[model samples]
Target: MAVGELSEKRPTRYEIEDVEAADRRSRWRFRILFAVVWLGLIIGLAVGLALTGRIDPAFILEVGPFILDGTPTTLLICFSSILLACVLATLGALGRLSGNPVLNAIASFYVSLLRGTPLVVQILFWYLALPQFGVVLDALPAGIGALAFNYGAYMTEIFRAGVEAVPRGQQEAARALGMRESEVMRRIVFPQALRIVTPAIGNEFIAMIKDSALVYLLGVREVLWRADVMGTRFFRSTETLLIAAVVYWILTIVLSFFQERLERRMARGDR
Candidate 1:
C-alpha cells in the first residue's frame, strides 16, 4: 500500500481502539456501580452506629466461637464419615459389578437400607433406639455413622458410574496382555474411573460436611449446636447466626477451590 493509503488505515486503528475502550468502560461501569451502592449502604450503617454509640466491630469476635465450634465438629465428622463412606462405596461398587449373587444382594441391601429411611430418623435410631438394644453410641459416633451410611448409598452410584465408564476395549487390551482381571482393574480401570468422578465425589464430600450439622439434633457439640446455645444464652441471635454463616461459607469455598485444582490435575493426565 502507498504511504497515503497507510495514513488512511491509521484512522481505522483509532476506530478499533475506540470500540475496545468502550467495551472496557461498559464492563467496569456496572461493576463500579455495584461497589458504590454497597459501599454507601455500609458507610451509612456505620455512621448510624457511631451516632448511637453502638458500633463495635470487635463485638463479633466474642460471638464467633459459638459459631466456629460447630464448624470444626461438623468438618471432623464429615471428613471421617465421608472417608469411610468412600471405602464402603468402592466395595459396594465392586460387589454390584461382581458375578456372585450373594455379594450383589449384600451390596444392594446396604444401599436400600440407607436410602429407604430418612437420614434424620436414622440418626435418631442410631442415637436413641440403639441404646434400647444395648448398642448405644455416643452422640458423635452415632452421628458420624449415620452420615457415613447415608452418604455411602449415594456414593455407590457414583462409584458404579466411574467403574462402568471404563471402555470395554481397555479391559480387553489388559486381558490380552496376560493381566489378571483384578490386576487390570487396579492398574487401569480404577484410576481412570477415579479421575472421571473426582468432581462428583468432591461434591459428595462437601455435601457430607453440610449434612453433618444435622447431627445437632442428636445433641452433639458441633458448630450449629454451639451457635444455638450461644444465641440463646447471650441473646444475640443475629450475631451468632452470622458467625455460623461465615464459617460454612469459608469452609465450602476453601474445599471447592482445592477440588477444582484437583480436577484440573486429573484432567491434565489425559494429555
Candidate 2:
C-alpha cells in the first residue's frame, strides 16, 4: 500500500478521542441505570404495599406525630451509649495492646464474652438478672450500659486495628525524642489512630442507632417502643411499625451523608 493510502486508513486522533469519550459516557450511563433500577424497585415496593392495603394511610397520619415524638429519646440513648462505648473501647484497645498480661487477659475476656452473647441477652441481664445481685438499674441506665458494653467489645477491634496500622517508626521516633511510652501513645499514636478509625466509628454509631431499637424490651420509650405503644393503642401495629422504620431509615441516611463527608475531609487531610 502507498504511504498516503496507509495514513488515510489510520484512525485520526480526534476519532480515537471520540471513542474514548464514548466509552466513558457509556460507563456513566451503566452506573446511572443501575441506580435507577434500585430506585424504581424501592418505589414499586412502596406503591405495591399501599395498593395492597398492607399499609394504612389513615393510621400513618394519626401515628406519625407520636412516633416522631420519640426520636429525641432515641437520639439521646444512641449518643449517650456511643459516648460510653468510646471510652470503654479506648481502654479496651489500650489493654489489648499492652504488655501487661493481666490487662490483656481482662480485655480479651471482656471482648470475647460480649461479642459471643446476643445483645438482647445482655440487655436482659443488665435489667433483669442484675437486680438479683443487688445491681438494680433503672430502664435508661440499664439500656445505656448494655449498649455501651456490647458496642465497646466490637469497637475494641476497630480501635486496635487503627492503632496498630500506625507505623512502628512513629512510635520509635517519639521514644527516641525522650518521650515515655504513655506520652508517645497520647501525643503521637492515638490521634492518628483516631483519624484512621473515625469512619469505622461513625459506621458503628449508625448501627448502634438501629440496635438501640432493642431498648424497647427494657420499656424505654424510644422510637420503636413508642411506635409499639401507638400501634397497640390504635390497633394499627403494621402502619406504626412502618412509620418507625421510615424514620429510622431517614436518620441513618442523614448520618451516613455526614459520615461520608467527614471521611473525605479526613482523607484530604491525610494527603
| TM-score per candidate | 0.79, 0.89
- Name every residue pair that clashes in candidate 2: none
Report the C-alpha displacement of residue 269, candidate 2, in angstroms.
0.7
Per-residue C-alpha lDDT of model 1 across residues 58-83, encoded as one tens digit per residue: 65787775567566678889889999
- Tens digit per residue, CA lDDT, model 2, 1-271: 5754655798466555577799999999999999999999999989988998778787788779988998999999999999999999999999999999999999999999999999999999999999999998999999999999999999999999999999999999999999998899999999999999999999999999899999999999899999999889878888898889998999999999999999999998964
Among all windows of 10 consecutive residues in model 2, the one with the lowest summed lDDT is 11-20
The Cα local distance difference test for each model comes to 0.84, 0.93
Error of 1 at 31 (Å): 8.9
**Worst lDDT window (10 residues) for model 1?**
49-58
Q: With candidate 1 superimposed using the best TM-score fit, by how many Å does residue 259's alpha carbon deviate from the native?
A: 1.0
